[model samples]
Target: MSNHKDEVEFPKMSFLLMAVTTGFVGGILWSLIGYLCYYFNYSTIEPNILLEPFTVGTWRESWIGIILTIILYGIISIGVALVYYILLKKLNTMWVGIGYGFVLFLVVFLILNPIFPSMKPFLQNDINTLIAAACVYILYGLFIGYSISYEHNEIKYFKEKELKR
Candidate 1:
């Protein structure tokens, strides 16, 4: 009986920890990817143009950009968690998580690009930025979806075990 209770509690705790860790790690990874893109000029017109518009003139702008990227990544991570929660509530599978991630990326991209017209010139008109954004978002979605799905599955498995007892 004690063993059963321990087993039941362990998974709940593990699931919660996994979810939090995954979100943090995914956020960091996404931010790192964004910084790399900016540094490599993947998102700029010229190889070093990411710093051109910012007046501090040095790579100090890159630091500011990194901070902003981290914030954006955190937002993306939270969005992924919410989407995963909704899908779990619906009794859907991991595939739904991925689908939601992709849909969210597209919807956000479309809505935001219009609001920030400056981004439109870089991403919409420029091929490099467009490709970089697409690739980064795809990787971000995949990682977040996979991590959440893994956590969700662990929770479901524990629930099933509890039911069997």
Candidate 2:
């Protein structure tokens, strides 16, 4: 019984640590994927594909761009984590995580991409960008859903055991 009670506490510090770590890792991985596509001349942006084509000479430039992009993505990832946490707090289910992920992608596609001139080119007659966005969002959703569900389950299990006592 005491063990169950202890479990129910679910070390806040640890959960937070895990969430941050997962978010960072997920962000980095997705960024790397995007970078690779860009580096290999597989990017949707015609200017990027032609002007400063991805090559050893442009490696440094690409690195700088990718890193900056990744940082931006990391910020988005943090927001995603926060949203997931909030949804879990309110709904107590992982389904909201999935919806949140889709919403994030939709906003990027419909609002951000269109409004941002730089992003306009990527979406213009480019299937790759769409595919990339889909892939990233799917992975992002999976990561969020898994992380949130895992945490929620752990807490719920602990609470149940505590009640049994």
Candidate 3:
């Protein structure tokens, strides 16, 4: 049996496919939603503009940029999902997801903004843009965080039930 210092330990599944899949789905969904918000002028930041640091040669300004950006979002989210599964999977609370998303907002906007020349400081963006981005991030976090924790709890419940049998 596994042991957690603060929470009940769960049985290990043979694979962690749920986390990976949730990452891609959450990533693509948030990127598209954010882009739509930008398209409708509610947000000033282009969803793909976060990729400015790794893209080059006018590519970021091209149609391919959007596709690549979405793919990158999926890739990055996989790691982020894995992190949530590892660190916060046992928390059993949705607030953790909201807090996690807010943390991500801070990391991306305040900490990582300097890495992307096109990104403005957190205080510089208008309220709408900030709200739009925050909502998107929070939604993404809720998706990943809630799903993982729910699954972990479900598995733990089943395992305990089986043990009692």
The per-prediction CA RMSD against the true structure, in angstroms, equals 5.2, 6.1, 7.4
Ranked by lDDT, the better of candidates 1 and 2 is: 2
Model 1 quality (TM-score) = 0.65
CA lDDT scores, all candidates in order: 0.61, 0.61, 0.87
lDDT of 3 by residue, 7-101 (tens): 87686554378888888888888888988999999999987776777766778757888888888888889999999988999999999998899
TM-score leaderboard ranking: 3, 2, 1
How well does candidate 2 score on lDDT at residue 14? 62
Worst 10 residues of 3 by lDDT: 6-15
Runs with alpha carbons beyond 4 Å of true place in candidate 3: 1-15
- How many clashing pairs does model 1 include? 0
lDDT of candidate model 2 versus the reference: 0.61
Estimated TM-score for each candidate = 0.65, 0.66, 0.87
Q: Report clashes for each candidate as comma-separated counts.
A: 0, 0, 0
Residue 79's lDDT within candidate 2 is 64
Residue 69 in model 3: lDDT: 89
Candidate 3, TM-score vs. the true structure? 0.87
Candidate 3 lDDT score at position 39: 91
